[model samples]
Target: MIKLQKNVDCVLFSVPPILLLGPHLAPALLKAYAEDKGFRVVCYDPSPGIYSRLNSKEQEGWPYNNFEEVFKDKALLLEEVNLWLDEVFKYNPKIIGLSTHAWASKFFIEPISNEIRRRAPGVQIITGGPVALDLGIEWKQNGWVDHYVVGDGEEAFLELLSGGTNHPNIDGKIPVPISQEAFRALPEPDFSDSDVEYYKQKAKGNRLYLIGSRGCVFNCSFCNVPAMTQKYRYKDGVEFAREIMNAQERYNTNYIELADSITNAAPNEFRKMCHELIRLKEEKQLDPKIICFFRIRRAQITQEEDFALAAKAGICRLKIGVESGSFDVREHIGKKETNDDIFFSLEMCKKYGIKVNLLLIAGYINETEEMFQENLEFLREIKRRELDEAIEMVVVNELYISRRTPVFDFAKDTGVFDNIDPEDDLARDAWQTQLSNGEMLDPKIRRQRVHSLKKFVSENFVHLKNLLVFAADEKFSAETGS
Candidate 1:
C-alpha cells in the first residue's frame, strides 16, 4: 500500500455534489495504479468537506442531484472551489486527475478545472471516467483540460505520466477498452489514501465498493454501457473472490457493493466466483455479504441454483433493473426478460432469503396507459405471490434522454425532439414523448405515474418500500416554480 505523500507526482480528486454513501472508487484505483508504476500519488475526495461548508438555508435549495445549482452563482461557486483548491495545491502535484465519471460532476469540471489551471499553471490537468468518455472532445476543444483518459484510466494515465501521448485512448482522440486479460492482472485499489473512516461513518454500514468486471453483456437501448465500455470483460472468478476477501480484510467491512453493471452478466464466471466465496467463508471463517446490480435472464442461464449458491456465498441483496413491467416496453428497451423470467428471478431470491431492490422507469417513450397498468398489475402480482417480503424497495424514476443512447437516437428520429437543436448536448431531459397510440405524454403525466406507482406500492405492500427520485426534478421545479 502507498502511504500519503506530502509532495506527490499526481493528485486525484472527485468533485462535489456526489452525495453517495461510500467514497468514490476511481481515485483509490488510480492511486494504486499510478503508485505501482513508481509514481507518487495521493487521492482526495473533498465533496463531503466542501458540501459541509454551505449554510443550512443554501443546502436546502441545492438539491443533492443537481451539480449546476452549485455553479449558478459564480462568486459562490468559486469560493467553494477555491477552498478545495487550497487543500489540493498544498500537495503541489505535477499532474492533477479529476474523476469526472458521475454526470452531475460535469457541471463542476469547468469551474474546478479552470481554477486549477489558473492557480497551478505548471500542473497538467487530466480528466477521465464516464463523462470524459462521452464529452472528452468538447472539454478538450474548450481548452479547460490538458488531456482526457477515456474508458479505463489506469494504463492510459500511467502512460501520460510517463510522457507518452497520441495513444488511441488518451488526449480525447478515442477510447479503447482494456482487454479482460489486462483487467484481471490489475492491482487492488489502495484505500489508504482515502478517508475510509469518514466514509464508513457516513455510510449505512461499514461498506466498501468493488467491481469484478467492466461493461455489460446486454446492450439495453436506454443504457450507455455498450458505447462507454465497447465490450464485456471480467476478472477470473478466483482472482475476484480473493480481491473481495482481501478488500474485506483491509477495510474491516463485510458489506461489499459490486459496482459492475450486472453482477451475473457472465454466468459461468459468476458461479465460479460464488463457489470460491463459499469455500473461502468456510475455510477462513469469514462472512462477507455482497449487494450487486443483477440482470434477470432465462432460467437455464440464470438458474435458481445460481441464487442458491449466491446465498451460501453471502450475497444478501440484489438490485435488479426491471426497467419496466410491460413486456412490450421491456422488449423495445432491449431487455428480453419476460414476466415469467422476472417472477422466477424474484421467486429464487425469495427462496434464498436475499433482499431484492427493483429499479423501474415510469415513463418510457412508448409506454401507454395500458402498458402502465400492466406495470401496476405486475406489482399487484408480486404482492399476490408474497414476493413483496423479499423485495426491500422499488425505486422509480422518470425516463431520461441521455446522449449516445439508442433511446436518444430513436427520440431524435421521431418528432419528439424535433424542436431541439441537433448540436445541443445539455438538453438531456425531455418531458414530451409521442406514445404508440399517437398521444403526447407530457411531464405532468409522467410525474403522476411516478407518484401513482409509489402510492400503490406504499398502500399495498407491507415490507416493500418505494422511492421516487429524478435528477431533472430540481431543474423542472426551478423552471416552472411548481
Candidate 2:
C-alpha cells in the first residue's frame, strides 16, 4: 500500500535516457517555477536510480549506449518502470508532468507513458521539453499524452496546472516564446527532491547544471535550437551570478555545467556575469568552476581580455562547435569561423590555461573527399603546432540528419536523400545521400573517415582524449571503440 504525500498538486518526472551525472535542468526548473507560484510539486528523476541497477558492462556503455538500446530490453525497461510507478504513486498528485528529449521520445517515453496511463487512469498527463515541442501533436494523436507544452513551459505549465487549455504553444498550437522578464524572474531551480548524493558520487564531484540563457544567436544549418527555444534570452549579469551563488550555497557544489545553446551569445551580459563571478569569488569566497558551450567569434568582437576574465571567473572548460575545419564546408553549415579565428581562439585559451573541447562533424550534405582531406589537414596542423595541448577532448561525429533542421531541407532540395518515410520519428541515416559533386558520402565512407581522424588524433595527441563518436549507423568499431 502506498502512502501518499499530503496536498501534492503535481508530480514531475525527468524521464530516462537522461545523463545520470546530475539533476536534469527541465524538471528542476519547472519544479522551482511551479512551487514558487504556490503549487505543491514533487519532482522524481529516476536516472540515478536506473543507473544504480545497471551492470558494470551497461554502466560503462552509458549515454553512448543511448535510449534505443535501453528501450529494446523490454523486460529491464518494464521492471524499472514498475518500480518507478510504485514510487511515483506514493506522491498521489493530481497531475503528472514528464520532461524528455527528442531521442528518447520514441524509445523510452512511449512505453513508460503507456504504463503510466494503464496504472493511473484518472491522473492528467502533461509533457514538455524538446521532445514535447517536436512531437507533441503526434503524441497527442496517439493518445499517449493529454497535454504537451511546446516552446517555453514556464507560463504554459502554470496555465495547465490551473486547467487551462487552447493556449498558444499548448496541445500542438504554434510556439510562443517566454518574455525576457519572465525568463529572468525564474528562480534558481530546486533540486531538493532528487538523489543529489547519488548524482554527486556518480559524477565523482559535486557537479550540477545551471542555465543562464536559452537559444543561440547563430542559425546553424544542422541545429534545431533556434527553432526549439524560439529566441535567445538571458538573465541579468548580477542575477545570473547570484543564482549560481545561491545554487552552490544550497547544493554544496562548486562545479556547474551551463545548459545554454551558447553562453556568450550576449557578450555584454557574459562580461558582466564574469565580473560579478570574480567579485563573488573575492567577496563571498566562492570558487565556482563552470563548463559551457562557447561561440568562437572573431578577435574584434571577442577580445583576448574576455578569455582572461572568463578564466578568473572560473570558466574551466569551453566546448566550441567548430563543426567543420574546411572554410567552405563550415560556411555552408553557417559557422563562419576561419582557420585564423580557430587558431586565435585556441591560442588564447591556451594562454589562459583553459581547456577546450572541439566538436566536429564528419559528413554534411555538401562534404566532398577534398573537403574531408582539408579537415584532416587541419587536424594535422593542430597536432603539428601542439595546439592539441589546450584541448581536453576532440568529439567527432557522423552528421545526424534531423527533419526539423535546415540541413534536412538542404538534403531534400538537392535530391541528396533516399526515400524517407514521413512517419519516422527519429533522425534518419542520410548515408545514401549523394553530393552535387557526384560523391556518395555513404555510411562506409563516413565511418572510414571518422576512423582515420580518430587514429591520427589517438596516436599523435595522446594527451587529448577523444570523446564520443556518435555513429548512429553502425555498431562500435574496433578502431574507434565508440
Candidate 3:
C-alpha cells in the first residue's frame, strides 16, 4: 500500500548516465524553483551506483563491477530503473520532473518515462534538460511529457509548479538567449541533504566537483552550448575559492573537477581565479588534484607561460575538442582551427605532463574516409609516442548529431536528414537511417572502423603508457634503449 504525501509540492528526479559525473543543470534549476514556491523538493539520482561502478567501488556492496561492465548490459539498467521507481513511489509527490541530457536521453529517458507514466498516472510528468530544448515539440506530441521547458529552467519551472500556464515567458534573471545575469543569480547548488555518505563511500578518495563559471563563447559546430544560449558568466573569484575551501574542510576532498565548458575562456579571469587557488593551497597547505575541459587555440597553448601556470595550479588532466584532423573539414563545420594548431596544442600539453583527452567526431556532414583515416593515423602516432613516454592520450568518438548544432543544419541542407522528427525515439531511429545511407560511412562500416580502432588501442595502450612515463621522466630513455 503506497501512501501519498500532499505536503510534497514537487519531486525532482535526475537520471544521469554513468559516463558523465558532474553537477546536473536540471537539479540546480529546480532547486531554485523549490526555494521560490516553498515546495518540498527531493532528487532521485541513480548516479550513486553509476559512480561506484565507474570509480571501481562496486566491490563493496554495489551491483556492478566497473563502468564498462555496467554500461554494456541493458538488464543492469532495467534493474536500476526498477529500484528508482520504488524510491519514487515511496516519496509519492504531486509533481514529477524527469531530468535528461543528450548523452543519456535514449538509455535513461525513454524507459523510465514509460514506466513512470504507467504506474503513476496521477502525477504530472515534466521533462527538462538539453534534450528538452532539442526535442521539445516531439516530446510534447508523444504525450509522455506534459510540458517542456526550454533554455534556463529556473523561472519557467517555478511558474509551472505554481499552476501557471505550461508555456510561460522565458524571461527573468536567467538569460533567455544568452544573458549572464541568470547564471550569476544561480545559488550555490543544494547538496546538503543529499546522500553524502553514499557518494563519499563510492568516491573512495576525496572528490569534489566545482562550477566556477557558466556558458561558452565559442560556437563549435558539433557542440550544443551555442544553442542553449549559454552566456559566459564567472562566479566571483573569491567566492569560488571560499566554496573550494569549504568543500575541502567538509569532505576532505583531494580532487576538484571544474565543471565549466571551458575553464580558460577568459584568460585573465581564469588566471585571477588560479592565483587565488594557488594562494589557498600554499597558505592553507591544501593540496587537491584538478581536472578541467578547455578548447585550446594554437596561440594559447604555444605560450609556455600559460601551460606552466596551468601545471603549477594542479591541472593534471585537460580535455580538448579536436573534432577533425583535416583542416578543410574543420572549416566546413565552422570550427576555426588549423592542423598546425591542433598538433601544437597536443605537443604542448604533452610537454607539460598534462593528460590529454581528445574528442573526435565521425558522422559529420561531408566527412571523407580519407579524413577519418588521417585522424586515426594521427591517434596511432600519438599512441606510438606514448609507448616511449609516461603521458596519457585518449581519443573518444562522437556518433550522435545534436539538433542545435550546425552539423544538423548542414545535414538538413545537404538532404542527409530527410525526416528530422524531434521525438526522441523517432528522431534517433531517423538518424540511424541517415547514418546508414548518408554521405558519411555506412553504419556497418562505421561499426567495423570503431571496432578496429578499439582493438588497436587495447593492444597498444600499455606501450602508450610506457611512452608517457618516458616523456615525463628522462631516466626512461636509458632503461628502454629507445
Candidate 4:
C-alpha cells in the first residue's frame, strides 16, 4: 500500500438502472480489484436515494422497470440530481468515477455530473462509457469531466487513482485495455456495499447475476463490443459453474443470469463447464435455470453435444444474436451465421428443450425493402414450420449505429457524418447513408416493422407467448406512473 494523492482513494458511481439494478458485475469486479491493491473504494448506487422522492400510494413500487426513463423530465431529473448531489457532496472525495454503458447514461449522467462540478470544483471527475474515447476536447472541457477512460475501466481507473501516467490523451480520453493476465487475476466480486435485498426484490426471487466472462471473439460489423472490450477473454465452464453455484448460495436464488455477451465463446471450456454443472446439480440436488446471451453457430449446437450438455446443465434460455434473416445482410455485416445455421441452431435448441430468444436487428447500412422482406420470409418460415414454438421471445430492434462499430466507420468513411466534422465523427446518430438511388432509408419504416414483428411474435408463438413474462416484463409498470 502506498500513500494516496487524496484522503479518500476512489468513489465509483453507478447510475441509470435498466430495471431496478440487477447486480452490476463491473463495479463489483473493480471494487474487488481495488481492495486487493490496498485501496479504499466506495461503491455508490444513487437509485435508492432517487427512489425516496418518487414515493406515493400508487408509486410505492417506485424503482420499476425502465424507471430511468422517468428522468427524461427535467424537473424529475433535478429531483433525483439533488439527491445524488447530497450523497456525492457528503463523500467530498478527490476522485469521482462514473460508469456509463446503456444509452440512457449519456443524458442521465449529465445533471449529476453538473452538480458534482458545481459542488466540488477541485474533485477530479472521470467517466468511462461508450464513445468516451472519441469525445472531443470541447466536450471534455465542459467542467464536469476531467478525464474519460476508454476500453476496460479497471486499469485506467487504478492508474488514475494512483496518480500514474495513462495513455496519451486522444482529445482527453485515456484509452487503455487491461492486460488479460491482470483481468484474470481480479478477485471474486465484493458486493458488500450494494443493496442486495433490493437486487433480490427486483429479481422477485433469489436471482443470481453472475459474469461468465468479458469481451467477445467475433467482430460483427454493427456490434459495439470491440470498442468496449478490446479482445476475447473468458473463463472456462467449470470455473463459471462454481461461481454460479457460489452466487446461488450467496443470493439464495435458483435463477442464474450469466451476464456475458457470449457465454460460450470458448467451445470446449463451455462443454467442460456444462458437464461440471450437471454433475454438481445432481450431487447437490440443485435446480438452477441458467440464462445467458450467446452467439449461435452450427458447430456448437449439435444434437448430442453442446446444446444437450447445456440443457442438461440447466441452461434454460440462450439469447442468440439472430441479427437479420437476410443472408445477404448478415454476410454484409460480417455475421457468419447463415439462414441454415439459424434454423439448425433453433432445431437443436428445440430437441434439447432449451428456449431461445432471437435477437433481430433491422435496417443494415445497405438494407433494402427486399432485405427486410427476406427477414419477413424468415419469420414466416419459422412460424410456418412451427419453429417459433421453440423460441421464448423475438426481440426485434430498429438498427441504430453505435459509436465505433464497423458500420459507423463505413458511414463515416462515406462522409455521412461529415457535417459534424472530425470531432463528432463517432456519433452513431450522425450515421446516415445516401443510397445510389438518391433516397435515404426511412427510420420510421424500420421502427414500424420492428414493432409489428414484436407484436406478431407476442401474439403468435404458442409456447413463447406463455413464457414472455419470464423472458422480460416490458409492461411491469406501464400504466402505474411510477
Candidate 5:
C-alpha cells in the first residue's frame, strides 16, 4: 500500500454520531488523498461503544433499524471518542480531517472539535461534508476549527495539504465545483487499516457502503443535495462495479450500500450499469448485496424491461424520496411527483419484489393540516393495497435549513423564518420543534397536523407489525432459496 507524505501524516477521523450505520464517506476521502496526493492516512472512528452495542444486538438477532438507535447510545458515544483520541495521539498526525454528515453534525462535531483542539493544539483541523457546509460559518466563528471545506473535499483537501493556499475564508458560502475527474482517479477508500470485520460483524449481514454518484439533478426545496453538489456526476459503471467487487472480495461480504445522493438519476446510464452488474454476476466476477437510492418518478422506471434489468443487477432495496402525499406540497418542494406517480412507482417496486423504504419529510415552509392528512390518507391507501409489507416508512423532522435551498427563499418570502441564526441554540431548538409540528402556517393548525400524524401512525400500528413479520419471513425465504 502507498504511504502518505513523510512530514505531514494525515489522519481521517469519522466522528459518527453514535449511529451504527455502514461505512461513511470519510474513508473514501482518505483513500482519495492518499492516492492523489500521497498523504499517509490513518482513520479513527470514535464510536466503539455504539459498535459494541450494535454487535450485541446483531448477535441477539435484532439488528439496528435506523440512525436514531445507533446515535442515542450516549455511553458508547463517549467511550468511542476517548478510544479514537488515543489512536490519533499515537499517529500524531499533522493534519486532522473530520468527516461530517447531516444527521451527526448536530451532536458529534462540537465535542469532537473541542477534544481535538484540547489534545493537539498544533494539528490543523479541517471539516468537510454537508454538515460542514451547513455549519461552516458557525465553525469559522469559533476558534476550534482552522479550516472548513464545503462540497467535495478530495481536490481542495489535497491542495490544502500541499500548502498550495491558506484555508479558504469560511464565509458560509458553498464552494465552487471540484472536477469529477479527481473523484474518478481517487483510489479505493482505505478501510483496510481499520477493523473492517468489527463493522461487518456489527452489520450482521445487513450493511454496506457505496458511492456511485454524487449530487442530484432536481432542486428539491427541503433537500441539501442540490446545494452541496451543484451538478450531477457519476463514476463509470465498470469502475463502480470493480469497486463493489473489490470491497466484497476484501471483506468477504456481499451487502453493498450505494451512498449516492441519487443512484438512478440518469436512467440510461443507470440501466447500463445494472446490465454490467448482471454480466459480472453471470461471469462469476461478482456476487454482492445491493441497495440504492432511486427517484420514484414513473418516467424513470416506466418499462418492465427496466425493472427486470434492475432486479437482475441485484438491487434488493430501493429508497425512494416520497417527500409528501399531497400534490401541492410535492410541487411546492419541487419533487414533481403526483399521487398517481407515487402509487404506480410503488406498485412496480412490489411487483419486482424489491424492498422499498419511503422517506417523508414532515415539515416545510407552508405545510398545512390538510396536507398532513393527505399524506396519512396516502399511507392508509398504501396499507390497504397490501404494499405496506413491501414498504418501510421513515418520517424525518427537518433541521438546519440551508440558506441556498429554495426552502430558505420560501421561508424568507413567507415570513416563517424571520430569525436566521447559524449558531443560536434557541433558534435551532425552535426549528426542530417547528419540524416536528409540521410547520403549520397557523398556530391552531399545528395541533391538528400533529394529531392527524399521530392518528395515522397509531391506526397503522397493526400494519407496521405485519410488515415487520413479513420482512422477516421474506428474509428467511431468500436465505432458504440461497
Candidate 6:
C-alpha cells in the first residue's frame, strides 16, 4: 500500500499534534539520512500550529480533560486542522512520515489522518516512534497507517529512500536493523528547521533536543525502551562530542536536552564522553548546557567522580527514573538500586551543582494505599532535605502499561485476552489494571490526590503557599502535647 515512487522520491516528515517545546529529533534524523544520499526531504511539524492555537486568546478549551474535550469546540479544532493540512499539502509529498512517540498522540492521529487521506489518497503513510515499535503490526491495523518502520528508522528509512519496496517484516511488522556500515555513517539530526524562531521564543534558543544513543541498558518492567530498540546501541565519545558541537554551532543553542532512554550507558564510555565535552568546553569550542536522563545503579551511583565530571562538562539537569518509593515495589519492577544509593546519587549531583528531578510513579500494577503513602513520604523527605535549588522537579506520573513491557507481559500471563481487552481504549489508561483474580484495580483514590499532591510536591517547603507544611504540622502537633 506504499506510494513509494510517486514523484522524484520526496519524503515528508511530520510530528503529530501536542506540545513539547518544539519538533522532535526523529524526523530531523530521517531528513539527515535521506538528504545525505541526495534525496528530496520535506518537513511539516504541527507543534507550532498546535501551540499557537492552544495559547491563543479566546481559545475555547484551555485545559482539556481529553482530546475529545478540545474537539468539543468544533470550530477551534477545525481551524487548527485546516492550518495543519494546508502545511501538509504544501509539499505534495510522495511519502509521509508521522511521529508516534506518545499514546496520547493517537487522538490527533485519527483526525489528522482522516483529513490527510481525504487530501492525498495516494500518499504512502509511514509511522514510527516508541509506541509504533512497541505495539508492532497490530499498531498498523489501527486503520490509519499503511507502512511502519518499527525499529531504529535511520538506516531502514534510508533503504526505503533508496527504492527498496520489500520491507523487513516479522509477524506482520517491519523491524529492520541498522547495519554495521549504516551505524558508522549515522549523522546528527539536521536542525535547519522552519521553527527556529518559534524555538527562540519558547526557550530563547535553548529548546533543541538531541539523542546520543538509543535504548536503555536496563529493561525495567514498565519501560518500553528495550522492546523499541531491541538492545542498546550508541555513538562513541568523539562522535557524541562532535554532535554536541555541531548542534550548538548550527542552532546557536544554549541548552541541549539529551533524549536518550538512559544517557549514561557503558559507564567508561559515558565518562569519556563527559571528559570530551569538558575538554571541548575548556577549548571554547562549544559551551552548551545539557539535561540528560540517567539511572542509579551501584556502579553509577557510588562513583561521585563521574557525576562531578559530568557537572564540569555542563550537564545541568539529570532526570532519574525512580519508579517507586517502596523498595519492595521497586524490586518488583526490576529496579536494583536501593534508597541509600539513590540518596547518594542525589547528594553527588548536589555536590556538583547539578539539578535533579526524581521521576516517580503512582497507581502501578497491584499498588495499594500504603505504597502510595510511601510515595508521598518519599516526596516529603526530599522536600525536607532543603537542598537549596539542587532539586529542580519531582514528576509523579501515572503508570501506564504499554506493549512489550514486562508489565504488559504480566497482564498477559495473568489473564491474556480473557480479562484484559487489548482493543478497549479505557483499559489502556494507567488508571486501570486487570488483576489475575478478575478484580480490577482503578486509580480512583490516586486521581483524587494527583492535583493536590503534585501541588504539594512542587511548592512544599519552598517560597510559596504551604511552605514546609509537613514539618510545620508535625511541630505544631508535638508542641501541643496532645
lDDT per residue, candidate 3, 237-296, as tens digits?
666666666666665655677778888777776676667777887887777667788776
Better of 4 and 5 by lDDT: 4
- C-alpha lDDT of all candidate models, in order: 0.80, 0.80, 0.61, 0.68, 0.64, 0.66
Candidate 1 has which clashing residue pairs, if any? Answer: none
State the local distance difference test value for candidate 3. 0.61
Cα shift from native, residue 360, model 1 (Å): 0.4
Question: Which scores greater on lDDT, model 1 or model 4?
Answer: 1
lDDT per residue for candidate 1 within 1-482, as digits (tens), equals: 33445778888888655544566788888888888889988787877786567677555544354455545788988988898888788888988888865666767888888898889888888888888876777788898788888887888888888878766789654568888888887888888866777767766655788988998888788888887888898999888998998887777664899999998988888989999999888887889989999899988788878999999998999998998889999998998878999999999999999999888888888899899999999999989999888888777777877766898888888867776664465554544877879777887788788777767776776776444355345332211100
Of 3 and 4, the candidate ranking higher by lDDT: 4
The C-alpha TM-scores of every prediction are: 0.92, 0.94, 0.75, 0.84, 0.81, 0.83
Which ten residues in a row are the worst by lDDT in model 6?
473-482
Expressed as tens digits, the lDDT of each residue in 1-482 for candidate 5 is: 42433444677777565345555656565555665565766766655544455665443332323444554776665665666677677777888877776444556666667777878778888777777776776776786577778877776677667755443423337666556786577677766555666666656654557687777878888776787777787788877877777777777654788888788787777877887788878787667778888887765455667777788788887888786778777888877767878787777777887777666655545566666778778888887887766664443333235567777666666555556463443353344224334553533344345444444654563434211111111221101100
lDDT of 4 by residue, 109-152 (tens): 56777777777778877776554655424346775677777777
Question: Residue 23 in model 6: shift from native, Å?
Answer: 3.1
Best by TM-score: 2
lDDT for model 5, please: 0.64
**What total of clashing residue pairs does each candidate reach?**
0, 0, 16, 3, 4, 0
How does candidate 1 fare on TM-score? 0.92
Global CA lDDT computed for model 2: 0.80
Misplaced by over 4 Å in model 5 are: 1-8, 49-82, 103-119, 166-172, 396-402, 419-451, 454-482
Runs in model 6 deviating more than 4 A are 1-8, 18-20, 55-65, 73-79, 134-143, 169-174, 179-181, 299-302, 415-419, 430-441, 448-456, 459-482
Number of clashes found in candidate 5: 4
